[model samples]
Target: MNKYIEIIKNAYTGYWNYLKHELISINHWDNYFYGLLCISLIVWLLEICFPWRKNQSIFRNDFWLDTFYMFFNFFLLNLIVLIALSNTAAQFLNDILSFIGISISSFQLFDVDDLPKVLGLFIFFVVGDFIQWNTHRLLHRIPWLWNFHKVHHSVKEMGFAAHLRYHWMEPVIYKSLLYIPMAIIGGFDAQDVAIVHFFNIAIGHLNHANLGWNYGPLKYIFNNPKMHIWHHAKNLPEHSKYGINYGLTLSLWDYLFNTAHIPYNGRDIELGFEGDENFPKDFIHQELYPLSKK
Candidate 1:
């Protein structure tokens, strides 16, 4: 009881303090709201100007759920992270590692300061993207994981808002897994992390958007709408592969891993799984639906 009380107290303190300083720094969170509004505005314009599917409605199905997910990811999930950390990420990771008998300090053997900032940032981006890509791939390939991932792919009308649509458990799984390797590295570039967050928000919105910007040859370099739409294709090339294009932020990982699957005609591609039209449209049921044995 005492421990739980302390955790709640600390969470309150941390959240209040976070709210106080959130606007003063871009890294704090002002950038998040800024990026959200900007990206949403830009996408809304582009979506109206150059829609890939002319028949789809601007409002879209599951729009409210996706809206909830955006706030959930940005605010609630982050609050969960803070609570899980008890205000300390390194200690939280060390505690988890200790429980598994893999005892290790949250420090690198060598100093990252010796490397140039740009080089260090490059390493961060590559390593982080690879970890995210692996997590995404696992979500599609594993049966249990697929249950949670199906929420995102259930939308027939893909758009900017669809990017954040995900099961609540996804951040818990992905972030916890990511912190394992990242904490071991003993370095964090706040600027690079911010840049990546901005880039991710922009690219994520564009990729799930109804707009048709293939970026041509650049499609091989970055994950674009054309490439990503195929990922949500109803009848994928094979069941073994689940769906195509698991890459996040970068397509290089998919290319190297031989998971890249793009068909010739990605236009007006059917989205969502077959025989799942009766899937729960409500938020609470959707989360529970994944874990239900029935």
Candidate 2:
């Protein structure tokens, strides 16, 4: 009980300190707080310059709402709740493993130091993306998870900020599943993960932006706006009942697993699900939406 209380208190303090640093300090260019703003600005400019949907307004539907989601999910919820919780969970798991006379370090599949830094980072990126890809499919296929994921699909219009408009629980789910696999292939540092993280953020913003870029032949490798817009299509084909285009950073997994589907240009396809009209529009309501019986 005391340990839990200490954890909570530390979480509160850590949240405030991190928040202050992120907001006030400009020393680190790689900080996510700044990175998110920079990426959003760049993508917004791209959307303004070469919008696929010419008729879509610059301040499209729920633009501000999605922007709020971006900061909330990335910083507020993450620093305040997830950081301490994840640390405590890791410690608890390690303690349990110690009691069982096992060391988590022994589970490493290979020493990342043995490979070149670039190759190691590439492997880490691909493996991490594959884990997220599978986790994304679970969000659509599982009823309980789909309830939370619906907050993302409720987007009526696509924008770069829309990329981060997902329920906070999503990180918990994605990171929890990613932890084991990533740890098993260990030796990469925070900088390595940050490189991949920021890159994925950029790609994700592009994928959700109102930019009709297919990357032509590269479409089979990297996910693009044209390919990802179909992922949010309200009317999916019967064959893809659970959803399709479950790619995170790369479309290679989708193609390899036979889940890739692009029947048309998808520039003007209707977004959201069947009953999206009734979905909550406000942030607070949407946060509690998944817990509701409805």
Candidate 3:
């Protein structure tokens, strides 16, 4: 009993320490929160001006659940798990290299200072987005991943806030996959990652907002609100016909891979899965429902 108590106490202390480090060491809380605020406002205005589904309410279906998801993601999701995972991976890799007498610091690919700030920013966006694009594809194609990903798609009435609706497990899986590619690229520090995250926060909301513009020629390059709405469309025959439009910030990948799908004026496509009515309404149920019996 004493041994078990000590083990529990140690785990609690470790968790508390991690929580403190995450809150203090990782700057950019202002950038993330305020950036999302501005994006949400812009998207909200656009939705009011040009909503795709006129009948969908300002307080749409599952609005509170989405709000819960947004706050949870902001407050909890990306902090402890990602930081701990990276630190542990770093320590493990360092230990292995130390055994082999190999110093990892000798291999910085690009000097972050030498590169133009704009170029660094672009590279940050492209690399991070590529990782996310692949993650999105895996979530749709892999059955096990699909179980967790279904929470996002279950939101039948899509809105700007729905951008943050995702399983908490997502960062763990995606961040684990991102580590190798990030190491290969090198020279990107926390600031570079923060900027890309800021850009994503804005762009992500815009893509999910109810606005109905495809941005003409730009649609081929960037994933716009219209193209993304179709991604959530349940009744669209192409859900099975073609696994369509899984790009994160850019539509270029979907075009290159032949997963892109946007018919002319395709704004009327139905959102959410056909039988998603069986999906739970509350936050707790949605989190656990995916783990229930097959």
Question: How many residue pairs clash in all the candidates, one count each?
Answer: 0, 0, 0
Ranking by TM-score: 2, 1, 3
| Per-model TM-score on C-alpha atoms | 0.86, 0.95, 0.82
Better of 2 and 3 by lDDT: 2
Kindly list the per-residue Cα lDDT of model 3 for residues 235-259, writing each as its tens digit.
6554454257888889989998888
Leading candidate by TM-score: 2
lDDT of 1: 0.77
Candidate 2 regions exceeding 4 Å error are 4-8
Q: Per-residue lDDT tens digits of candidate 1, residues 1-294?
A: 465566667887777576456545566443666568678779877998898888877887777778888777666766665455533554655667889887654345544457788877777777788899999988988888888988888887888888988887787778767875765664676666787778888888999888888787887778988888888988877644576788778887878888888758687777888666888877888879887943
Per lDDT, the best of the predicted structures is 2
TM-score-better candidate, 2 vs 3: 2
Residue lDDT tens for model 2, 1-294 = 677678778877878887888888888867878888999999999999999999999999999999999998888887767877776777677778999998889898897879999999999999999999999999999999999999999999999999999998898898888877877998988788789999999999999999999898999999999999999999999999999999988999999999999998898889999899999999999999999945
Model 3 clash pairs are none
